[model samples]
Target: MAELLDDLRAETASFEALLRPLGDDDWERPTPAEGWAIRDQVSHLAWFDDAAGRAVTDPDGHRAALAGSGRGDGPGDVAAGGPAGSWVDALVLEARGRTPADLLAWFRTARARSIEVFTTLGARDRVPWYGPDMSGASFVTARLMETWAHGQDVADALGVTRPPTARLRHVASIGFRARPYSFAVRGLPAPAEPVRAELTMPDGAMWTAGPGDAESVVRGPVLDFCLAVTQRIHLSDTALEMAGSPAREWMEIAQAFAGPPGRGRAPVSG
Candidate 1:
């Protein structure tokens, strides 16, 4: 567990490293994610990291903190109060005029605070978070997943390629675990049968989940699966493969990550 938190901190650090080198123009660049600019994406990560730090250091604060502290809510709920498409619209409007350096500093401070709180926690501590109760370890994993997922958007904004990291397997696993909620959010039955997901990790090792010989299969690079769940890498992109009835069903509304089901984004290609 300590190792996982350490890795998460490292991932956050690497993500910040990527953020720091961006040109000023890069911060205002529009991403494929509809209304979010590169700066908004960074702010989103910073907001969640700060909130998670608060969740750990002051668990009994307000309901808003408790409600948005989980892995799923990081990017999803920033505009939860408004109508469809209003959240991102509002956020982008608010983020205007913020320089890339401003966003970078926000992220750096938030991430440092998060690492501090995370490192101090006992593994067994139950942090009040969105969706469900999470151990400190689970919370950290969610943060790592969020870092990688949002990092993809920043990479895309810069038209750069980030080498897929082994940590993405951890991110993909969270998305897989959220499958049931995805179905529920879409008003569908959670599948009774398990779907097999076999991903080739960045290191060329296979990470398999769910039942083999199961009625459904989702195969591809783990990075794609992570992106699919996070709604960063489009399904149409050269990232993942899907097969079987359950796999197809899952893809129709495969928002394995949290926040108000992102129904406002442009159609994810493929």
Candidate 2:
């Protein structure tokens, strides 16, 4: 738990560093996430961070606050009419008048509070989240995943290339574990056969998941796999080698983060 928290803090710090140098104009730059500016992306993170803290400290209050906003039926509830993305859009719109500094400050405060709560909680304790309850470990990993995924949008909007690091192992793990949910959410049956993930890390070490003898395999750079699973880049645009029917199909519709099905990026032509 301590190690995971350390990694979470590192991921948060890296994201903050990315946002720290941007000028006011840069905050309004449109990101690849349809209709969301850089500010909107950061604001979304800030809102969720605070919610995460509340979930740890006061789950009932969190649900009440979410219901009060008419954002959804309750905390983490996306059953309301319209696309799940609409809930996020509404939240971002509510913060339209906030300055970039205000957004940053909110994020920092919320992040600190979340970290404190997680550090104090028992590892086995479950905390309510937007979609489902999560253990202390899963909760931290979820936050890390969000921070990295959103940071990718901010980096793309600025035309900045942030090299992938070993921290991506956590992101890839989430993507791999989300395989069944990815299919279930789309009303498709998850394949009975398990898919193996074999990725080469940035430091040249290999990360492998699943049984070695599994018939399905996804092999490539960990970075590309992370981007594909996060829906930041089309699977076809990546160099990942898919070895079985299940692996290929999973890559085609992979999504690590929760919410409704995402409109993944278009393929890049060679």
Candidate 3:
């Protein structure tokens, strides 16, 4: 528990460091997320992190808070089998009035509270979320994944390339396990066939999932797999090699996060 929570803390702090130096103009810069500026990215994380804390410490209050505020990414937010976009838009509008400094402070306070609350959970404890309940460790990993994914958006907007970290294993793990949810959320039936993930980690270690002879395989750098699952980049743009119909089809619409059928980025044009 401590290890996972520690990683979550480290990931959140890393993102904070990135935001600390930005000014209002920088906050307003548009990211790959359609219609969301850098400020929106931070605000969304803050909103969800705050709610995550409330979910652990005060589940009823968490539900009530979301109910009062229009359920940003709530279960009822379904649209065309995906979570609605208005949820994030509503969250962004809530913080649009704050200056960069104020927003950053809000994010820091919210994240700190969430991490503190997470420390109280036992290994087997489950944390409630917008969609389904997740194990305490999974909850931490999910938070880490969310930060990395959104952080990618911020980095891309700034034309910055964050070096791959050992922490990417958390993101890749979620992407791999979410294969079923990925299909379900998109209103498609998850293929019964399992796809193997054979990825090379940042330090040249092999990370794998599924059976070796699964017939369908996605092999490449773990970083690219995470980016593809999060929809930060089109799969074809990555160096990943895909084989079998299941692997190819799954990669085309993979979504690691639980909200929407993401409007994944288009293939990079020359």
The per-model lDDT (C-alpha) reads 0.72, 0.82, 0.82
Rank by lDDT, highest first. 2, 3, 1
**Candidates by TM-score, descending order:** 2, 3, 1
Better of 2 and 3 by lDDT: 2
Off by over 4 Å in 1: 64-98, 122-124, 264-270
Q: For residues 1-270, what per-residue lDDT tens digits would candidate 1 score against the true structure?
A: 788887887788777777776778777787666556778778877767787888888877735644564333334633212134544455556656677777778788888888888987777779876656677777888889878767777777778898888888778878888888888866778788788899999888999999777868898888777777776644676456778778867865677556567652354454
Give the per-residue lDDT of model 3 (tens digit) for 1-270. 888888888888788777877877999998877677899888888878887888999877776776677554543212112334565566678889988888888889999998999899886787767677788888888889888888888888898889898899989988899899888876898689979999999999999999888999999999999998878888878999999999999998888887757667778955
Regions of model 3 farther than 4 Å from truth:
63-85
Clashes of 2: 1
Q: Tens digit of lDDT per residue, candidate 2, span 1-270?
A: 888888999999989998999999999998887678899888888888887888889988866765677644322211111154576778888998999999999999989888988897776888876666677777788789888988988888999899888899999988898899779778898779989999999999999998899999999999999988888888878889999999999988887877667778867766
The pairs that clash in candidate 2 are: 76-130
Clashing pairs in 1: 72-258, 236-269, 236-270
C-alpha root-mean-square deviation, each candidate:
3.7, 3.1, 2.9
TM-score of 3: 0.92
